[model samples]
Target: MAFSADELRVLRRALATALNPAPLQGEDVQDCLRLAEAVDDAVREAGRLRAFLLADLARYREALPGSLPGYLELLQDALAAGYDPAVDDLAALRALRANPRAAVLLDRCQVLAERSVRARLARVTQTAVATTPRPRVRLLALPGGRAADEPKPTPAPPPAERPVPKPSEVFPPRRRPVPPPPPEERAAG
Candidate 1:
């Protein structure tokens, strides 16, 4: 992503053109358009790579304690890449928390998850305010003022009818006690 001096000069000229229209050679305009397209392509490629990384991480997680080493490595790489931890990721880390690395990642992932959730809630709030219809309140006038009959305003739905879940409900306790596979079946398994 490092830009050469020539590219920097072109970028500066392009930005100046944006602020104030000026006659420019066709070559300069073409360069700016090409740069913009290149940036867009880079963004799309990054998104695809991130999606692949997340799917691979999920696969590794499903493999459980056996995939511990790879999963931890991938998780750290993902965190560095600004990946937000989903519930499954948090659960996986919690299950593996006995490993010191997993414990640290669990704490990190929890913070990332909380921040991601808060960001989403904020976006939803903004969208709701911008797009949701406001309930119309009917006004009734006293005898001194002129009044006209109007339909009653519909009530707003009860806010968030479902209760917020407790932490335990969101993240259940770790592994259940299960008898190890009987010796007779271990080899077959």
Candidate 2:
């Protein structure tokens, strides 16, 4: 963006007018308009450059762990140059974090990945609700084959309840014979 002598003169005059707040001559007005257009073009060019760098950064990110030579270096350089990380960049970096060799990028990738998820979640929450159809409800009948017009049969009466017997009535105690102490004691007696 090397400005020629004529363009530099015009820019200086434009700046002077902007700072001093003076009414501009016809030529000065033209120069100011040209400078404004140049500023806009510069802004657009900067945006394009950022887009290019971000795209390149994403490509490098995708080639991670087993990336080609200089891929990581390029990615880091892009980060240093303020290239914004895209969702895909964060995802690729997250995938790479599982590699032992990717330890250096793990924390950075994790933070960016978390931010990406939050951003996506915010976007989804802002969208209209999903368009799934509401389910229809219908009546369900019992398994009995009786017709609706027929008289219902009465249910059978329950059996009489039986009383529980005492534990002694259920089981009788058994009698056992007593054994003598010892043969020596019996001989002494």
* Top TM-score hit: 1
- Candidate 2 lDDT over 44-103, as tens digits, reads 997898778777766765666566335656666666765545566556656666565454
Assess each prediction's global lDDT (C-alpha) against the native.
0.90, 0.71
Candidate with maximal lDDT = 1
* Residue 92 lDDT in candidate 2: 63
Q: Could you estimate the TM-score for every candidate?
A: 0.66, 0.44
Please write out the lDDT profile of model 1 over residues 14-120, one tens digit for every residue: 99998999998999989998888877888899899999999999999999889999999999999999989889999999998999999999999999999999999
Worst 10 residues of 1 by lDDT: 143-152
Candidate 2 ranges with C-alpha deviation above 4 Å: 1-9, 97-102, 109-189
